[model samples]
Target: MTDLNKLSLAEARDALRDGDVTSVELTEACLKAIDAADVLNAFVHKTPEIALERAKAADERIKAGDAPAMCGLPIGIKDLFCTKGVPSQAASKILDGFKPEYESTVSQQLADAGAVMLGKLNMDEFAMGSSNETSVYGNVVNPWRRGNDDAQLTPGGSSGGSASAVAADLCLAATGTDTGGSIRQPAAFTGITGIKPTYGRCSRWGIVAFASSLDQAGPMTKNVRDAAIMLEAMCGHDPKDSTSAELAVPNFEAMLTGDIKGKKIGIPKEYRMDGMPAEIEKLWADGAEMLRDAGAEIVDISLPHTKYALPAYYVIAPAEASSNLARYDGVRYGRRAQLAQGDGITEMYEKTRAEGFGHEVQRRVMVGTYVLSAGFYDAYYNRARKVRTLIKKDFEDVFAAGVDAILTPATPSAAFGLGEMTEADPVQMYLNDVFTVTVNLAGLPGISVPAGLDGQGLPLGLQLIGRPWEEGDLLNTAYALENAAGFVAKPGKWW
Candidate 1:
């Protein structure tokens, strides 16, 4: 049973195929693991009834010789994705009692692939904060760390719960959406592998809108192979989402060569910020050395627009967030507040939203409103868009200059104390995304793979980024580094 938790999705599928284990047995094992790890707050909802039923169906199909690629695998769904019968709150009080009539396209696709639905995982309210503390259900503890004291650790957000669950083996692999580093950051913090594909590769049809132009759904898993399998199943075109690309979906799993020979990896000079921890720096350097040993050339390159990326991302993401969040006015969806004397529906909406949103959420809404307001639109939003263009242009130039991909540190440092940045000024939290936000702005693919552990016994992640629609190359490079680093640390077993 314990070995089931350590098996990759492919291995589990083979075990089921070979009749060494049944879907029912695997699901029960995961359920037991979840029950034992409930203190971590990794799950917001556990649909055991639904999960078992699906597992039974999968087992029957496998017995009938109709097994699919991901048949019978239990997977975690992030709370942000709308589930048909589950409350999809995005972990915010404003969304209390809200349920969608439709299942998100990616979720539907996963179901079509025969993956069992474990439950919805926790996340920061409305995907607003870097740490999970902003979740109304409370923070998700790092499963790699023990104890209940919130200050001892943090699960990176807004996809922190998904990361935590996957890291702790609560689920095989999970779905994650990235607007500005949400998936990649948390995956880095939790010492797991997550990929943010090129924008438009995955459908965002029923995903809760954050920054519409930037929101993308991707996979979070224990290794590149499982991630590749999930990504292949999750990606497709949806006519409902106008931005969903009409390109051909590749066989991601079949393409894993584990060979990235002769690839030109560009080390972006500007990403090495001054305050970056020495451990993170060494991880990046070591990653370069690993690639060099794999017969890939490492070239030092510059992304001059990087200095302006975080500022531009903050302005644009918030501006879009402010506009998208207007739907939660209490009349159509989400919670409604009681009116005070002389207050009507307008006042009710104002109070409900004000009381429902967390600090970081409210801050972004205010910034969004201010930037999109009549007097500031041109000065703030427009300028930010122009800078975004420049950042994209920077990547195009580098890729054109014989760079197959770029390599850098996934996060500035390893996971910090849970409360370390919660009470901090917003800018400090914003800066934590410095190394990652630019890739989203450019509509490119990026991934985080565990590189090594830091001096503090925390995990450090090395990031590999690819040009648009080049997830094949991105995953190949990551697999190469994964082999070289050979760093896999499991959370302490308490069961």
Candidate 2:
């Protein structure tokens, strides 16, 4: 029999329904795989009992012929989502031992759809860093490595564990939040499929906040169809979250006809950055050609404000983060530092924060506080907001001109070794999000599909940004790319 854990989410769902497989058998296989793959550090918090219980229930639902698309599928829940009675630290030391009584809206919806939870995946501390190295649980390693080297590589950031788990077959799929490319970037690095729905598409309630305006929860799956199915289950109008979209959800998987005929795909000129790795440029062009061959009309477009997106995002995300994270003081439910002699409330706050937040989180908090401070708010924070508006306008103008979607490279390069870019200059590290942050700024739906591999044989992905609220169309284009590329490379088992 095929390795039960190796089946994609969609395949597993069908097999469960057809009696070729049972949810319990699949869930147990995943549980056992997670146990053996601990060296990857993908599953930060394992919940075997809950997983098996949920699987048993899902099996009963399937037997009764009352199962949703996600029913009986085992998946990893990112630590960012609050699962009732489960640890959800968001990979931050301050939130250690922080378990919420309520489950996140997205997770609750998935549970209602009959998906089994295997465990919580790790992420960057407060979803700050571009690489997974900022995680309090330590970096989530990429299953793919350079040609013959065994050196550990990052699974990208914030949603790193989600990408790693899906790519490594630790889970059929996983829940991930994309705040400035968290989901897409990691998915690219891991050679999988991920889509960040328009900001506000997924309810933010019960998930730990990062930059409130930019954080969007989406699926990281082995294929685009699975991403669509899981995303449908994860999104809806939530009265609890003011940002959740009110429109009725569509059948995203059904929209995957793999036909982009007559679609006008725009190729933004600005994204051809100076010193971008040649392979990325070639991969972007190759993707455009594939789309064109699939009957998509490739048109040259300009997004002039894109150059400012990274700078603007660094300012806006951190500024909001500084505000959102203010709730994590010592008086909260999370860890409180040991009190010293004469330590009052003020001392407790300082000590707890200093001991809790990692270096990257602290650095951003300082930068955010500085930008929002009285003396510099206008010079920095306010100016960045203005830039963000222009960036959004760039996409709007292009989409208004009959362009169905915009195509670009997901990341400038494939996965890099852990600690390769972190120690020296931080700016070098921040560049990883250059291709991805613009989508967040525009609140546009974007997807990254593995198109080719880089020189090191690591996977490279092409991104397609769709019009706001038109994710179904965007996903259809991605399906075309996926079919055209025929990218089926998987990381050789080494862990």
Candidate 3:
């Protein structure tokens, strides 16, 4: 049999249903691959025992003919998600040793669908960084290197581990959260598929808070079909999360007819940033041509608020983060500092926070606190909120004008070497989300499909942003682009 670990989620599901492979066999294969790929630092916590037990149960379900679409599939849960009794640290020291007593809504739904939990994947601390360097588990090394060079690259973040694991075939698919491009950017960098459904598509109850309004959970998978399948399993209404939508979930996989003829795909003129790399420009043009060849009408559209997305996001996300993250006071759970004899409760709080949180988390928290402060609330946070409304309106107006989806480059460039951007200004690092944050700000469903390679042979992706609550349309469009691009390149195994 071919490598079970290398099988896509859809293929594995079909194979399992046909009795060609047991869930245990598939789970073992992923566990073996994960054990050997430790250099990538992708799976921060291994749960082989739970995986095997769940796999056995899944096998029984398959035999009983009670299987769902995700039955018997081995998938990694992002650490941001709370899996009962599992260490879900959110890759932040502040959350060190924190294990939830209940599973996150999305993970529980996957579990209910008979998906086997392989383990928890790594991520940037509090989902704060773009390059995954801010992860307390060090950095998740991108499986794809630049040509023959030995330099280590990032898998993008804060969903870096999900991207790395899926790209490396460590797991068939993994859960990921997007707040300002976490899912799509990493998927683009690692040559995988990731989708962030419209806000409230997936319940955020058990996921660690980043930017409450901006945080969304989605699937990171090997292809568009797998993304659709896993996304369906991960989405639904949850009364636990007030923001979760009450709408019914669709059979996203069934919607992938890939017949995008006469579909109006918008190409936003504002996405053409000054001094953008020639390769990215060429890749965008090539993607548009491919879609055009596939009979999609590529039309230029304007999202005039594009330029303010990053700044507004930086302000708004940090502000919400400041409010949401106030719960980690050391008095509750996770890490607490060892106070000196003279230290009081106030000192303990200060010391615990100082020791527990990472630099990036602290920086964002400070920024958030500053923006939400009494004197600066209107000047910064409220102003950014108004800008966010304008940004949302920009997409609403475009979509109302008969555009089915908007196509653009997923990221500014391919995966860069680790520590390369960290050495530059932090704003340079934030610029990585320039092409992606607008989707989050506007609360729309967006997907990244690996479209082509860069000059150095690393992968580049094209993003398709669909109308609100229209992930099926977005995934089908992505499927069309996937067929047109025929991007079957996998990173050479180095880990």
- Which structure among the candidates has the greatest lDDT? 3
- Candidate-wise lDDT, in order: 0.88, 0.93, 0.95
TM-score between candidate 3 and the true structure: 0.99
lDDT of 2 by residue, 408-472 (tens): 99999899999889557888999999999999988999999999999899999999999999889
Which lDDT tens digits does candidate 3 get at residues 17-127? 999999999999999999999999999999999999999999999999999999999999999999999999999888889989999999999999999999999999999
lDDT of 1 at 43: 91
Between candidates 1 and 3, the TM-score winner? 3
lDDT for 344 in candidate 2 is 96
**Which residue pairs clash within candidate 3?**
none
- What are the runs in model 1 whose C-alpha is more than 4 Å off? 146-151
TM-scores for all candidates? 0.97, 0.99, 0.99
Return the candidate ranking by lDDT, descending.
3, 2, 1
Kindly provide the TM-score of model 1 when superposed on the true structure, using C-alpha atoms: 0.97
Count clashing residue pairs per candidate: 0, 0, 0
